[model samples]
Target: MPGMGFGIRIEGLSKRYGEGDTAVDALKDVNMTVAPGEVVGLIGPSGSGKSTLLKCLGAVIEPTAGKMTVGDEVIFDNGWKITDLRALRRDRIGFVFQAPYLIPFLDVTDNVALLPMLAGRSNGDSRKRAKELLEALDVGHRAQAQPSQLSGGEQQRVAIARALANQPPVILADEPTAPLDSERALAVVRILNDMARQFQTAIIVVTHDEKIIPTFKRIYHIRDGKTYEEAGQALH
Candidate 1:
């Protein structure tokens, strides 16, 4: 019901960390298409430009050259086609970081509601939407609980709920299950799959965790700023 067929599209994405002789080419000619409701893994060793690509795709940093499209909008073309990149990020993109990073003072519900509220939705409406997402993630029972009261898995679930609060077209996850055990790691992947299917969102998880690495049906391996795609072994 929320923005179906909302996949992420990237073409010729290249990033440079500096300029002139000191510049480092973080990403080189990175091109990828993530279909709606599809989940893929981006795996690489440290310093392979994974972070750079994520920054570019998430609009946290501009790419030196590339085109980026989210859902029905073209966000970047050579330079950004849209003004207000921050607003675009808030409205069109969702991010799940390695850590849950929920606020200590705010309860789970408030944390999730914060996104919609920031985007001009009413506080009540935002909280309502947040509650719905919490229920969907099976964390509604802990809505009133503070971050400190929840387990690691529960907090991660809340983080995921927060990410989906806006129902963004694309969700970028950076080591989403890094802090969990094998059981919890697999659970997070399953949750990601369910969320992608339910919301028809494109998800890219950047991770080095071996536990969940094999679960991905498609994997992108990056080395020295270049990428090669591989079809993973069957999950069944």
Candidate 2:
């Protein structure tokens, strides 16, 4: 749904572990929305519900209660509205983990093309699309290089390209630059902002990295099962 004027919409999203007195509420009636082409940061300290919220939104775990929509698809409502979360995740959402996690044996192009291939696209079309994203992300020159041969930044970029391979409406990036230096971290953030704008993808980045925290226009800080939305100052 690129440039389709649609994005993530969440309401009363909640999650809990266990039950009754032993239950721990990881999320508490959370509500938020992100527009198309927008980028926001999700920040919180250890033991907070940052990961819990991400898991809920990513469809990795079911919420105890809530509603969620990825782009135009209502994936969850009280319970899941869709039977196949894996398909929804693959077709409508994208994800970037703390590490690039690129397959060691695959070259950069194959690492990205793999997702489309899994989705049943032809190898030629998948590789063509992969090359386009690699070029857009400025990693085209290294398309033939194996993951083992790339720098930290290059690996992260490849991971991002893979996430975009499906042209998903939303992308969840969990600590994407945690392993990079200050300069490299900032570079990742800059690239994220640019890519969100270019592709009209809504991006939510979960991170504890202090260096790029203030760069977000808006930040959702979760603590003890609650969330506090705050405005952030831009970096120079």
Residue 220 CA error for candidate 1 (Å)?
Answer: 0.8
Runs in model 1 deviating more than 4 A are 1-6, 234-236
**Candidate 1: 10-residue stretch with minimal lDDT:** 1-10
Per-candidate TM-score against the hidden true structure: 0.95, 0.95
Per-residue lDDT tens digits of candidate 2, residues 1-236? 23555589889988989989999988999887777787888888988999889989988899999889887878899999999888888877889999999999889999999889988999999999999999999999999999999999999999999999999889999999999999999999998888888888899999999999989887888888787888888563
Model 2 is weakest, by summed lDDT over 10 consecutive residues, at: 1-10
User: Candidate 2: where is the Cα deviation over 4 Å?
Assistant: 1-6
Distance from true location, Cα of 77 in model 1, Å? 0.8
Model 1 per-residue lDDT at 166: 88
Q: Pull out the clashing pairs in model 1.
A: none
